[model samples]
Target: MDPFVVVVLSLSFLLLLSLWRQSSGRRNLPPGPTPLPIIGNFHLIDMKNTRQSFSNFSKTYGPVYTLYFGSQPTVVLYGYEALKEALIDHGEEFSGRGSFPMLEKVFKGKGIAFSNGNVWKAKRLFTVNTLRNLGMGRRTIEEKVQEEAQWLVKELKKTNGSPYDPHFIMGCAPCNVICSIIFQNRFDYEDKDFLSLIGKVNECSKILTTPECQENGNQQTIYSLDHLASLVTGLFFAGTESTGTTMRCALLLLLKHPHITAKVQEEIDHVIGRHRRPSMQDRIHMPYTNAMVHEVQRYADIAPNSMVHEMTCDTKFRNYFLPKGTTVIASLTSVLQDSKEFPNPEMFDPAHFLDGNGNFKKSDYFMPFSTGKRVCVGQSLASMELFLFLTTILQNFKLKPLVDPKDIDITPIGSIFSTIPPTFQMCFIPI
Candidate 1:
C-alpha cells in the first residue's frame, strides 16, 4: 500500500465525481454532443473547418445548441431566427464579450472589440463618437477612401498587365485608410515605420484565438498608453484585414465570373461614370453594383464565427439554461449561408440580393459584419471603403485572371478564423 497509489485513487475518484456533476448540470442546458471530462467537445469540432463543423452540429442539435470548448460551455446560435433572438431581441443580456487567452495578453481587455461591462460601454461610445467626429460617415472619410483607391489603382497599373501578386497591394490600401482615420494622416506604402505598424496589425489579426481582459489605468477617466495601443491595434487590425480580405475575395470571385464583373463595371460606368469617382450617393442608384457588394460579403463570409460573447448572468433562453460566463457565438456563416433565405446559398449570385425589378434587396439573414448591440463599430466605414475601392478599381481597369476564369480557385486558404483568399496575381488592364 504505497502513498502514491492512495493519492492516485483519491484523484481518480474526484475526477469521476466532477464528470458526473458536469453531465448532470447540463440536463437543462441546450443539448449537444456529450463532452469528455477534460477535453470536452474539442474533438467533436474540426479545427480547420470550424464553421462547417458548427453547421453540421446544428443539423442534429437544432438552431440553438451547446458545445464545450475545453471545459467551458459555449452556446451557439445558428441561422437568422436564433441569432436575432439572442443578439438583437435579448441584446443586453448577451452583450458581454467572451474571454480569450491570447488576446487577454495583448488587449488586456481595453479595446472596444473585446471589452465588456462599463469598460466596453465607455470605450464603444468614445470610439463611435470619435470616429463620427473624424468623419466616418461624412465626406472627409469618403475623400480619404478615394485617395487610397487612387493610390491602389496607381500601384496596380505598375504591373502593366503582367502577373503580379496583389496580396500586399490590397492590404496596403485598407490599412492606410484605417491609418488615416485613427492618426489623421495616411502613410506611404513603403515607409519603414508604416510597414512595421502594418506588420503588428497583421500579427494581431492572425492570433484569432486570443481573448481579452481589462485593468485600471493611470488616470481613471483616460485610457493608459498600453490600453490605447491595444485599442488602436484592434481597430487597425480589424479595420484593415477584414475589409481587405473581403475586397480580395470580391475580386477573386469577379475574375471567376467575368459576366458579373462586367455588370459591376457597367453599373459603375452608368451610375457614377468614368469622369466622376464612384461615391456613396451613387450606391442608391446602382442596384446591381450594390447587390454585388452585399453578395460578396455574404458569399465570402469572412468572419464566419462572430466575436465570442459571454453571458453576464445565468440566463434562460428558449427553455434552455445558459450559465453565467458561458461563451456564446452567433455564427455569421450559418446566417449568411442559410439556404432558406438565400436560395442556392452556395452559389455566388448577386441575384440573391436583387429583386425581379433589378432593385437592391436586403435580408435579415445577411450578418457578415454581424448584427445586434455589438455589431462591428467600423461596419459603415468598411462598407464605404469596400464600395469605393472596388468600384474605383473597376472604373479604372478591367481585372483579368492570370489563368482561365474556370480554372481560378475561389476557395479560401485558411478557414479557422478568417476566410483568407489564395495568393493570386491579376492583370489590372487599364480601361
Candidate 2:
C-alpha cells in the first residue's frame, strides 16, 4: 500500500473509534442533534445566546434533548412542563450541582452555591437557619432593607433630576442589604471603604457570615474556613448581582414604558401614599405594583440558564433515561418566556400577572428565581428587596428618561448565563 494510504487509514480508524464511543455513551439518553466526534453540538450553539440555541433544539427534539459540550453529553430540560417535571417532580435526583470549569475554579465546590451531596446539605441548612434566625421574610431584614431604601432615595434626591447612569447607584442598594445580612452593618454611599468593598463584590461576592455561623461550623471537613469564605463570596456575587441587575432592569423598563411606571406609581399613591415608607404590607393591597414587579423579573429574564444540575442517580424521566452523573440544564428562559402560560410573552405586560377582574393573578410559569430543591435561597429576601426598593423609588420620584419613551431601548444585553439591561442614563425627577 502507498504510505499516504497507510497514514490516511490510521487517521480514519481513530475517527471511527471516537464516533463509536460517543454514540455508545449517548445510547440511553434522550434524543437530540447528532454530535460530531469532538466538538459535538457546539457548532449549533450560538456562544452569545446559548439559551435560544437550546430552545431551538427543542423544536425538533421535543422538550427534553441532549447536547454535547465537548465530549461530554449534557441534557437540557426546556419549557414549563419539562422543567417542572425535572426540577419540581423529580427534584432530588436532579438537584445535584453540575460543573462549570471557570466558576468551579473560583468557587472550588466548597460553598453552598457549588458544593453537592453532604456538604451542600450541611451548608444549605446552616445558611437557611441563619437567614431564618436573622428574620428573612419577617421584620428584622425587612427593616434593614427599608432603611436602605430610604438611603437609596436620599442618594437619588442628590441627583436632583440630572441625567446620570444608574449602574452604581442601583448596585449599592442590594450590595448594602447583603452586607447588612453578612456583617450586621450598612455603609454610606460615598464611603471610600464602601466603594472599595463594592469593587471587590463587583469582582465576586455573597455571604452572611456571623460569629455564630463561624462557631457553629464543624471546621473539620466541608465546614472549614475555606468553605465559609466561599459561601460569603458566593453570597456576595450571587445576592448582589442578581438583585441589583433586576432592579436596574426594572428602572430601564419603566423608562422605556412610562405608562407602566405611571400605573405602578398610581398604585403606590393609592396604597402607601407619599408620607409613609412602602412595606411588605403594601404588596398585598398594591396589586398593580406587585404584578409590575413580577413582570419586570419575567421580562428582564435575568439568570437565563440558572445553575446547572447533575443527576444523583440513573434516573428514568418522561420515557428517557438520565444516567448517574449526567449533567442537566433546565433552561429558565424557556420557562419565563413561555407563550402558552403568558400570552404574548415577548410583550412587557404586567397584565400577565393580572386577572380579568384586576386582582393579581399568579401563574405557575413564574420561575424567575427558579424552582424546586435548588431554588435560589434568597428568593424571598430578593423579592422583598425588589418590591420595597422599586415601590419606594417610584413613590419618591418619577423616572425621567433622557430620550423619548419610544426611542428608549429596553432590550437586554444577552449572555450565556444572564440577561442584563444595557447601560443608559435617565433623570430621577422628584414627584
Candidate 3:
C-alpha cells in the first residue's frame, strides 16, 4: 500500500471510532449527570467524601443512578427499597465484586470477603458454617466476648476517672475477640506485632477510600499474588476498624444519654447480676439492653458503602438497561436513615427498635451488616461482641465524657471510610 492510502485509512478509522462511541452513549443507562470524556463523571465525584455526595446525587438522579469513574460505569443504589431490590431480589446477578486496580493486584481472589463466583461461594459457606460450628450464636461465643469485655473493663478502670482516648482501647477489645475466633488466640495490649497490625489496618482503611488512590494515574499494575495481599489487608482493615468504630459510637451514645445507659445497666444488673459476667443467654431476658445494641448498629451505620457489587450480565432495572460489569454500590447509610423505615432517623433513640408495649420490634430496613447474599460474613460474631462488650462495661462501670457533651464531635472526618469516633476523655466510675 502507498503511504498516502495508509494515511487516509487511519483518518477513516479514527472517524468511525468517534461515531461508535457516540452511538453507544445513546443507550439508556440509569439517568445521571452527563460525564466528561475519558474522565467520565469522575471530576464531579468526591471519592474522598462520598456519603453526602452520593445522597445528593440520588436526590437529583433518583435512587438508582449511573456514574463513570475513568472508563468504568458504576451504579449507585440509595435508600432501602432500591438497595433491597438490587442486593436481595436480584442478588445473584449483582454478586460480582468489582476490583480496583490496586486491590485486584493485591488480593488476587484468595479471601472470602473479596473473592467471588464459585470460589466466593465456597469460602462464604465454609466461613459461615465454621462460625456456626464453633458456636457463633451459642454460649461458647458469648463466653469469649464476655472474657474480652472483662479485660476491657479492667483497662478502663485503670484510667481512674482521668480523661483518655478510648477509641484505640475500645477498638482493640472487639478486634481481639474476632482474632480469637479466627486465629484461635488473643493478643496482649502491649504486643508490638498486634499493635503494628492494628495500625496497618487503620492506615489501609484510609488509603483504600482516598479518591487519589483510585485515580487512573495513581493506580499501579499489581499481579495475582500482590492482589491477594491487598485483599487481605483490606479485609483486616475493614473487619477491625468498622466494628471497633461502631463500638466506640455506642459508648459515646451511652455517655451522652446517662438515662439510657442507666436503664441498660439496670436491666443487666437485674438479669445477669454483677457476681458473674453476662452471657448470650442473658440477652433474651435483657430486652432493653438488646434494643440498645440494635439501636447502636442502626444509628452508627459504620460501613456506609458496605461493599461494591457488579452486574454479571446485561439486565433491566425499572425499565433501564444496566450493562454487564457495571459496578453497583449499596448505600447502607441511606437505608438506616430512611424515614419510612426509622420514624426518627437522626435521633439516637432505642425506641426505634421497640414498640409501644416495650417489646422488641424488627424493622425491615435495619441493615447495618447489610442484606443479601454478600452480607457481612462476621455478622453473628459482631453482634455477640457488641452486646457482651457494651453490657459488660456498663454493668461494672459508668461511661462519661472527659470533656463536655457539647465538645464531643460526631461528624465523620474522612471519606469512603467514616471513623467518627468521639475525641473525648472519659472515666470509668465503678458502680
What is residue 119's positional error in candidate 1, in angstroms?
0.7
**Pick by lDDT: which candidate is best?**
2
Whole-model lDDT for model 1 versus the true structure? 0.84
- If ranked by lDDT, best first, what sequence of candidates would result? 2, 1, 3
| lDDT of prediction 2 | 0.85
Candidate 3, 1-431: lDDT as tens digits: 99999999998897667546744763778887776556777778777567778889998999998877665667889988898898899988888787756556445555566666666665567557767887787877777788888888888888887777787897788778767776788899879988998887666556654656421111132224454455446446656777788888888887777789889988987998887888887888888888899998888777777767878788988888878877888888888888886888888889888889888888888888878998887777778788888888888887777667766666555556353553666777887
By TM-score, how accurate is candidate 2? 0.94
- Between candidates 2 and 3, the one scoring higher on TM-score is 2
Model 1 Cα lDDT, one tens digit per residue, 1-431: 89999999999998899789879878988999998888888888877778779889999999998897767788889888898999999898898999777667777778887787777887888789988998888899999999999988888888888877777777899999988888889888889998897787677666763221142433464466766777788888888888888888998999999999999988887788887877889999999988999999999988887778888788899998888888898788988998888999999999999989999988888888888889999999889988999999999998888889999998775544566777788888999
Q: State which candidate, 1 or 2, has the greater TM-score.
A: 1
lDDT, candidate 2, 165-244, per-residue tens:
99898889998998898889898988998898678765542221110102133548766788889988888777788898
| Candidate 3 Cα misplacement greater than 4 A, ranges | 1-23, 46-49, 209-238, 417-419
Q: Residue 111 lDDT in model 1?
A: 80
Model 3, position 59, has a per-residue lDDT of: 89
Worst 10 residues of 1 by lDDT: 209-218
TM-score of each model, paired residue for residue: 0.94, 0.94, 0.86
TM-score of 1: 0.94
